[model samples]
Target: MLPRNTVDTTVLPPGERFGMWLDLVARTSAPLRVESAHAADFAARADFTDLGAIQLVEYRYPSLDATRTRKLIRQSDPELYVLALTTSGIGTSSQDGRRSEILAGEFTFYDASRPHDVCHHANEPGRTRATSIITLIPHAALPLPPKRMAALYGGRMSGSEGLGALLAQFLIQVTGHPEQYHAVDAGRLGTVGLDLATTLLGRNLVAEDAVPTEVRRRALVTQVQAYVHRHLGDVTLAPRTVADAHHISLRTLHRLFEAENTTVAAYIRDLRLARCRRDLADPALRAQPVQVIAARWGFGDKAHFSRAFRAAYGMSPQACRDGAAVTARDVNDLASRVNSARAD
Candidate 1:
């Protein structure tokens, strides 16, 4: 796995929690003046992951207000661009004379070398905490001009659809399940993140035509794959539908997946089969009919699904489920025997 370290303020004495957090934030992130209502007994946690040229930090804390002033910048400037995506609660940011309210499922950009104000709070009742994932990218690493990037300072960006959704989902998945990725994936993941960020920014600025063709292509492929994964259960989902949704030609879509060394239909089929195979092995779904499980994954023809399952797993769906049941029974019987022996 990539190098990751977690810091929790709760581990320190209540009186020292906020101080330690402040220092830690200054070191891991940029220098800033930070305040919190829970300062006396601040409860916060953050995970910092190093991804080659970039870094990702996931934070969970109570209401906070932080300012990156000229003094702080003069004290230590990282010359980095920080993209703050709030996963929960609401927040506001100000930079370059622009202030924007960023709600949950939204993000904003700020430059560490410039002055900015950020506040994270929950406007809803009964919610006292806020969560966010921050991405730190060095200014030199970004290909866009500073003037163009400056226009986005403190601008609200939605993570609801298009490139924004893909980037948001990617960050969330990586932070939520770091164990799923390996150290070898760090550089590749970082490049993908940069590409997606560049594409999103370029699109918003109406300068996507200026982005490198290869970067745009990679970002589009990633978006298409995400879309396919999300609509796997839709029987109407096909290569043409995927192409249309992405506003690309069917031939172009085929070419994109070709670079991945797979056809669109084959990709969808493999994913559906994988889902069906997993469901068959799940004990909770044991009582469910095999056809129902297959149909749920867009496999309309029972015989076709059965044939596909057999070809993929070398076993019929019923046989796979029965095998899982036998294994489960064996484990349970062994456990019961061990308990009985201990009782005697």
Candidate 2:
């Protein structure tokens, strides 16, 4: 992510600022009629990031009116869903004959493919700028029904609580702290973003079942994986137990795992083995016996644990731990090494 542009109307001959703003907006977003005083005393800036499947843009600007007219719709209709999250501003919007009043800490959606009107005004004049996060989501990327969502356009939605709050929190974190995530994980983040958005819309409409099965499945898989990792020390963490915890049937849980090319039991075993591998290498746990280590990771039977550990690491747990003894954090300082690799 990088700063796309910074336009301070104050430096310009007042008259040229509004025209330049129009051109800039026309190139980045849809063409709209911008209404402001002739003084052109406004100032604005924007930053954009290309997050695979979605475009995230942060805008800081003064109060203005943006109107999308029929003529502009005829000029071009970019079928995109724009979500405007107001961070510090008071705004009003109208679409589909519905009007909504919004304040700071709120969000609303508008269809870029149709006509709409927006009025963004500042709450206090001395603020840095009326900032907002605008997410451009393609029509095909959203899993919820479009018409159903359209009915919600131009309505004030709470982003301060519930699922919408989670979505809002995630957006703020990802955009504000990009270093916390890996670049390779951008696509996954996008998927989660869409799922949260769909779930939020479904909840707002009081029709969660309308959310697509794929959307729900992906979301459930994410939640279940976290739950499993958190409770991996429990020997009773079996497929039936996991299914019950999630309020889903055992068959459905198994099917969800299968979609990821594994079974519920296998996923648990792999994670357990991973934890065991990490523990066996810990210098503080060197005095601990292999049986104790195995039990710590939920492997109850001694013989079964030994055989499974050998099958997974090509060596018994004891042998692996003996070879894993190290005094330093890096491999360059390691006294011995053992290849403990497994595919899941």
Candidate 3:
């Protein structure tokens, strides 16, 4: 197993910090060159080996000028493509006549060989917490036109929705549980990586229709489901809005859902009910009125919410909430009994 590698520049001078960064880059590939206005005070860690086709790295740094950062990237690895998820701080990058500002909770991709700049500003001095998962993959592996990738290079892609959400969650999980993964899992993750990259590229290019029929169909359904779940609070949300978001006809949207043995309306209701069920079981909301919780999850009529809840769980809404409390206590008691038995 590969042990995690971590480095904190706060403990080292500028020269030593740059030297450590160089050593890290060299460990994976050729030697890297470094340059900066004032040397970077940064920290980074890697938890996996480079034996896999792709490598993941987590890095953080304070605010810096765009020109200097681009220069460093170019000198370090001119042929690699870098996809960065900015967790904090604000930054902007420009390429191919397109310029975009990346704020927290967004992602941007760039190529090291291209001359691009990124400027970062912290909300407060010495308080920047920019967590990025940088994936290094060969240019040929992308399987998309260079122009299409460049079009998306500096733009903010939504990481909290659909495939982006799945991708972000996977990266976060692996960052914490790198040891649980093996070489086979890494290869599978690479396939997912390509799917995500392709999806993002298709969105940027306005050429989703150009993707293979099955892949496009699956991606569209995923995007539609995400949209529905996000807008459940809006009473106006319906099949029309879902179709409008993806620029498809309502009839076609229904056809897509039919493939999964569902209609859009049924799917939305099921999702809303699931959300309400979760809220009813939450201990923190025990004091809140059940009607308020129902409305919060898009159930406008209290009577209707109760009927639906009972139909789904075979118990009234209030009874279901009470049952959750009993279940929690029973689980606690069972755990105690198991511990006592183990001790005996």
For lDDT, the strongest prediction is 1
Candidate 3, position 306, lDDT: 89
Q: How close is candidate 1 to the true structure, as a TM-score?
A: 0.88
Models sorted by TM-score, best on top: 1, 2, 3
TM-scores for all predictions: 0.88, 0.64, 0.64
Whose TM-score is greatest here? 1
Off by over 4 Å in 2: 1-19, 37-39, 124-126, 221-344
Q: Model 2 — TM-score against the truth? A: 0.64
Return the clash pairs for model 3, or none. Answer: 66-118
lDDT of 2: 0.79
Q: After superposition, how far is residue 236 of candidate 3 from its true place, in Å?
A: 3.5
What are the per-residue Cα lDDT tens digits for candidate 1 across 1-344? 67789999888889999998898878854778899988998888999988877899998888899999999898888789998888888878999899999799987999999999999976667866799999999999887877888888999888877788889999999888989999899999998898898888888778888688888889998888888899999988899999999999999999888778899999999999999989999999988999999989999999999999999889999999999999999999999999999999
The residue ranges of model 1 lying beyond 4 angstroms of the native Cα positions read 1-3, 179-187, 326-344
Lowest summed lDDT window (length 10), candidate 3: 29-38
Query: In candidate 2, which residue pairs get closer than 3 Å at backbone N, Cα or C atoms, i.e. clash?
Result: none
lDDT of each: 0.89, 0.79, 0.68
Task: Give the C-alpha miss distance for residue 2 in model 1, angstroms.
Answer: 5.9
38-136: candidate 3 lDDT, tens digit per residue: 455544333443425456676666544544244454456547676666666776866656788877667787776666667665564567444566666
The true-versus-predicted C-alpha distance at residue 98 of model 1, in Å, is 2.2
